[model samples]
Target: MSFILFLRQLGLSLAEIKAILTSDYSEQTLLLNKKQALQEEIARLQALEQTIDDQLQQVNQQDTLQVDQPIHLRVLQRLPFAQDFDLSVVETIDWQPDWMLRQLYYVINETDYAICMATPAVSDYQIDAGCYVTTTIEAASGAEFDSALAAITTHQTLPLIGIEMRGTFLSPGKHLAVKILGNRKE
Candidate 1:
């Protein structure tokens, strides 16, 4: 044992020291177990959706998010709604890391991705000119925001032109977009 820990536990019995060593990890392990439980619940619900959604003639195919595909995510609420969306690509920005919380995020078939806010009249440099993984966008402000929500809620497909998904590597107003690739089911 390190001198610091040895001295710290000098007064404790050997059994007590062992407990301290292992007990430190118990709380974190329990919390991580909850993640698995949540995942299993999600799988159960998805199975239920698939089994009961037989009204459609065939199983719904996955939507391949193509390069430069512009997806719309609303910033109206703190939560951007996370789900498979009837089994499409992960289009919504649902969760963010600590420092990154409360900011706009994006994802792809993602492959989850991110984007950023842009000016109304965007410069050509900020338009369809970067690598496929990143882009910028002008999120709907004022009345347009409501319209976007309605359209996305009803149609499940909203074509947003010009605006790129905010990227962290880009300039100010750029939002981070992530795309996880590989390990796709056949």
Candidate 2:
């Protein structure tokens, strides 16, 4: 005879029969439900892992492009002519191995002066001889100086340390406005 029928014949109430059946099967049902929940959680975590791997691949590809790009920096200011008729512009720049100095622009209010840049060398002497870039300015405009600097092909890549405008100025209140431009791989 069925368990439920046998229990009913023994004078068990309907609520008592239901309670016995539920207690007998409750452990198995609970274990099955827990297993199903765990499987769903594992599947969700696997999908998330796949998504993270795809994003990492994209970031690696972008990093390669970024390394080939060039970063440009410049410094611009007007310096007064000192009593020795030389305006000294000192700029201490720390350059990385990938840096490439591209161009230099200068706009002097006077026309007769020459511009030179010096840097510390590997020799015992602290200050190396300067490199002469330009000697005369036709105009005092920024655009004119930029154009002039662009035409010069002899400006080699050198370490920037100090800059000076040497020679006499035409007027008493004359000053020099200089711009240094460079590029580097990032």
lDDT of each: 0.35, 0.38
Q: Using TM-score, give the best candidate's number.
A: 2
lDDT of 2 at 83: 16
At residue 17, give the lDDT of candidate 2: 67
Look at candidate 2 and give me any clashing residue pairs: none
Q: CA RMSD for every model? A: 17.7, 26.9
lDDT of 1 by residue, 1-186 (tens): 683365244444666556657666464564466567678777667644633442121123222223343323443122233332221332353333321222233222112223333223432212232233212223334244334444443533322222222233333652322222212123
Question: What lDDT does candidate 1 reach at residue 18?
Answer: 65
What is the Å distance of residue 156 in model 1 from its true position? 3.3
Question: lDDT tens digits, residues 1-186, model 2?
Answer: 486786676566899768867776564664576578778777667655644553453334322211222222233333442212222433423332212222222323232222222122332112212322222333355466546544432353433222222221323454443323222232
User: All candidates' TM-scores?
Assistant: 0.20, 0.21
